[model samples]
Target: MVRGKTEVRRIENAASRQVTFSKRRNGLLKKAYELSVLCDAEVALIVFSSRGKLWEFSSSSRKLLGETLGTCSAAELHELGNQLEESLRQIRKRKQCILAEQIAELREKEKSLLKENKLLHEKFKGGNMLHLNAAEVQSMEVNTQLMIGRPGTL
Candidate 1:
């Protein structure tokens, strides 16, 4: 007969729960050991029981793991810091180049606009105009002259 799948939930009986925990913990430790041996890999396992009992397994000694990991982490952190600093430097350089390019483009546009404005002013001044009085024309001419000499005039 095909058995139905067991519903996984917390065991209500304290004795059954303890038995299950013991079985599972042993199975897990066995698997960990098998994996380390078969793969020739470093493995560590730590388990705590409800009774505050601690179980641990490691392919390497705890002191060796601590020392090696501490040194590796420090070296890795230093390398990472250097890489980040270099990346930031490169980013700043690229940003400066982009800003310079934008500034040059804006300067060129400003110059073009100023030239256009000067031409328009000259055209207006040369044409006969009955609407503008002498003072208005003089004021316009003075403003045009000021704008032409300025560096950032639009």
Candidate 2:
């Protein structure tokens, strides 16, 4: 019997975690070897430590099993990566298309505003010309009064 069962969650105390990992790793390798010998079966196992160290064992011919498993793993990873990349590409294209439509809408609004401004400018110009003609008539009346300074000349 042992003291307590260990949880899979991270161990806050580094020293305890290291001790546990060492014990468990040895036991796992021993079990794999025993199973292979007793059952006359092939076994392959790979483990990576928290520190990135790799551990592996195979009961069958190492060359044959390693080649076969490696090939399959590569193929599966390639397929998964392709799927993820295609999904991302589709998302980006949709975003670009939406932005393009927004830009077109803004351009149409700008054109409408420009046409309204042109009409306002034309109205202002016409009103200003009318005021100028009225001023000219007032000047002409003042000149006529000066020319008829003598009452008999009227």
Candidate 3:
């Protein structure tokens, strides 16, 4: 008969534990080999058994676990750095374009505000113009100052 489901925690029985360990160790090594083959990748796996036996596997011996991947020579490193720098430069160029557009929009808003201020000031002066003469303009300025509770020389 088949056994029921078992928890993944500590195995209690000693004989069953040994059998499980051997089976899992083989399975893990097989999986590592299959992964390296199927993915076309540099793979390394280090496994230590319960008896302290160490097992390791790698696709290449020269390019070990501690070694950097894909870059065997200084030329490769320089080429890779250039490619990365160009990509970053393109990203910065796009950011600069966006900021330039925002600056143009702010400048347009400033111009609109300046134009609106000029129009309002013209309208206020038109309404206060009883006569276009200099003396009449002076008198109007004095009257406006008095209305706003300001002392006027006129």
lDDT of 1 by residue, 1-154 (tens): 9999989876999999999999999999999899889999877777879788988787753533233545456776676567557867997999799899879999999999999999888887788554688987787743354445658756
Among all windows of 10 consecutive residues in model 2, the one with the lowest summed lDDT is 63-72
lDDT of 2 by residue, 1-154 (tens): 7778746665779998889888988889888888999999876666668999887777874533235545457676676567557867997999799899879989999999999988888887876744567667577543354453766766
TM-score of 3: 0.38
- Give the range of the ten consecutive residues with the poorest summed lDDT in model 3: 141-150
TM-score of each prediction: 0.40, 0.39, 0.38
Per-residue error (Å), model 2, residue 109? 50
lDDT per prediction? 0.78, 0.74, 0.75
Best by lDDT: 1
Error (Å) of candidate 2 at residue 81 is: 16
Q: What order do candidates take by lDDT, descending?
A: 1, 3, 2
In model 2, residue pairs whose N, Cα or C atoms come closer than 3 Å (at least 3 residues apart or on different chains), thus clashing, are none
Count residue pairs with overlapping backbones in model 3: 0
Ranking by TM-score: 1, 2, 3
Write down the RMSD of candidate 2 (Cα, Å): 26.0
